[model samples]
Target: MFRGNKDEVFVRQALEQADYACGRWIASQRHFDVDPTSLLEPLAKAAVVTAVAIYVETARLSQLEVQRALAIETVAQARALIDRLHPLAFGGGWYGGRALR
Candidate 1:
């Protein structure tokens, strides 16, 4: 139970960090009209994914039966918001030069 609580705290912190990154990306986009392919987008996405993964893993390790739909929805929403806002700004890849995968 103590470990579960600790993991929950960590997950919350990660999610907060992810939210901050998303806010930064949104500010950059709104103020500077930055491209979605910029570093901010990937950084925000990475943060968001890391947070969601942490939550999912914590729940698994804790033997807590949580619905994964929420996690999936969170990721989907973040991706859509990040990509939809700057549809025309996707000329370059995420890393700027070439695709990572």
Candidate 2:
């Protein structure tokens, strides 16, 4: 949904892993390989793999911050503009007020 090539690698890896996992689950579903009840082992392995990937990837994502810097910069620029128009003046008689320096 994000507008860039950023998710390509992630999506590709997810598809590959999903396919592999489905194959493994299917393989253990017949009177051929290990006991069909052993599907939980591979399922558990897939869960662990997905969980580790999520942990590591989310940690990395937290480190990406150029967009945050740009947002802060935009707010600073807006503050400067507002300051230019609203200089506070005080401590002058009815004749005039001192222009804020």
Candidate 3:
């Protein structure tokens, strides 16, 4: 089993945040006022950004995943993307890796 410490806290937080974004997105979907396509970038960005947070936490991942998540051009979009992430990324001991068997 893998034990994640403070060094990896950011990744965990990212994953949790990603989760929250998904939930919120789902909630928004239930509404007639908002169009789902309007949220495409934010939701996708949240997932990707959170994935990068997970990569940062573990310092382990595929080049493609890293490229997709961490290699961002703007800090502002990254920050906004991070904000929309699910809070659980900071909680629960997820390593962006698989559950330890």
Candidate 4:
């Protein structure tokens, strides 16, 4: 889990939103044929949520340089953990690389 109160709140909000969207999307897709790969979508969204939480929390840092560095590092770590748990989650690409900038 991550540190910081605001960060936790942000992550919770993101996760709730992701859940809502995923539920809606899945329901909408029920009419169509299902594929095994479709199950990975939620995992990918979770990775993105983790990265955004890190970015949001790190931005509160006092120093600009430190904030930027920490954001990238934390996001990378989150992505790595997600990728390790579900290798197919990100499709072999780092998530949220552009969001940090």
Name the top lDDT candidate: 3
Q: Alpha carbon lDDT of residue 23, candidate 3?
A: 54
Count backbone overlaps in model 1.
Answer: 0
Which segments of model 2 are wrong by more than 4 Å?
1-40, 61-101
User: Per-prediction TM-score, please?
Assistant: 0.26, 0.22, 0.27, 0.23
lDDT for predicted candidate 3 compared with the true structure: 0.47
- Candidate 3 clash total? 15
Residue-pair clashes per candidate: 0, 0, 15, 0
* Candidate 1 wrong stretches, greater than 4 Å: 13-22, 25-41, 47-101
Candidate 1, residue 64: Cα displacement in angstroms equals: 20
Candidate 4 lDDT over 1-101, as tens digits, reads 65669876986886677664674554343422344333334444444455444544543322342333233323344344344433222233454333222
True-vs-predicted CA distance for residue 58, candidate 2, Å: 0.8
Model 4 alpha-carbon miss at residue 93, Å:
16
Q: Scored by CA lDDT, what does every candidate get?
A: 0.43, 0.39, 0.47, 0.42
Q: 1-101 in candidate 2: lDDT tens per residue?
A: 56687687787776566765675554332322344333234443343334334433543422223232223223233233223322322235423654333
Q: Write the per-residue lDDT of candidate 1 for residues 1-101, one digit (tens) a residue.
A: 35658877986785566564565653344432444343334444454445344444643322121222223333345555445322223335554532112
Top-down TM-score ranking: 3, 1, 4, 2
TM-score of 3: 0.27
TM-score of 2: 0.22
CA lDDT of 61 in candidate 2?
26
